[model samples]
Target: MLLISRENRELLRIIEEQKPSSLKELEAATGRKRSNLYRTLSTMAQYGIVDLVRSNKRVKPVVKATSFQVEFGLDEPSQHEKRRS
Candidate 1:
């Protein structure tokens, strides 16, 4: 999933610092539209970057991951090839 972006990073920061109780509160804190925040947070939730908790009939966003590590090697054999061998 494409999770690294300026807007997403900012949203993470806000969630970490403000700790808003619900999406509406987050919308106010970030001055972003509710629809936009919902879409973005939904995507983040799917990627396990954040958690959407339902409390008191409100959806709250919680940051589950604070950092990321990416590793790739071109010299490594493909998984399909290794399995065949």
Candidate 2:
């Protein structure tokens, strides 16, 4: 199961509520340092959960999903389950 940390959830909320146009704006909205926000946003971007658009010298974070659902033990075989012969 994938886990969305509390901090990441807050970041998503900030993006959805404020719709910041740049990293600086997001920093202001979230009260987080730009450098830290950049790193976290970068990681989120890689996971396709967030989009970081680069224009001129600014990177804007866009929220793709305000919330997510996780399913556990659905895709994986249980320990007691055995391979089919």
Candidate 3:
């Protein structure tokens, strides 16, 4: 799943603003199901976007990144490469 998807962006916003203490509280705050939230958050955790901390037997979601940087290029060679070729 893309980290910058609309749903994920919204989830990041909620986590940053509300700072819910548990998954249940996050579920209520976002109006999303526990299963779905867990799945999404787990994925985000894997990407270093958020951290799922265990406290008092509850998992707390913490935002680690609020912005993203994307860089891409076509398969064609660059001007410098063409010059060398």
Candidate 4:
């Protein structure tokens, strides 16, 4: 159950729009630094938020998910609230 930050939500949106994406492609698409993007991807990977789809030498990393769903339970804090605190 991911809290679904703005960045994570945007990443999912980009994935849905692009179908498949690599690290470089996503970095470019989101205008985020490669290192930061990688960190976010790693976090998502740790949570099973995204599935690694493909990779290439010239291109960036790629991933896919059944659906971009943010499962925020009543007990969990809202992303906005988390950010505030």
Per-model TM-score versus the true fold: 0.77, 0.75, 0.80, 0.57
The 10-residue segment with the lowest total lDDT in model 3? 1-10
Q: How far is candidate 4 from the true structure (C-alpha RMSD, Å)?
A: 7.1
lDDT of 4 by residue, 1-85 (tens): 3436776777777876785446777777888887876677777777777665544543344445545655667998988999999
Whichever of 2 and 4 has more TM-score, that candidate is 2
What is the per-residue lDDT of model 2 for residues 2-74, given as tens digits with 9 covering 90 to 100?
A: 2378877878888988899999999888889999898888887887889999999999999886767766777
Query: Cα lDDT for residue 31, model 3?
Result: 94
By lDDT, who's the top model here? 3
Which residue pairs in model 1 clash with each other? none
Maximum-TM-score candidate = 3
lDDT of 1 by residue, 3-77 (tens): 678878999999999999999999999999988888898998888999999988899999999998878999999
Q: Give the lDDT of residue 65 in candidate 4.
A: 58
| Candidate 4 local distance difference test against the native | 0.67
Ranking by lDDT: 3, 1, 2, 4
Those runs of model 2 whose alpha carbons end farther than 4 Å from true positions after fitting are 1-3, 72-85
- After superposition of all CA atoms, the RMSD between model 2 and the true structure is 4.3
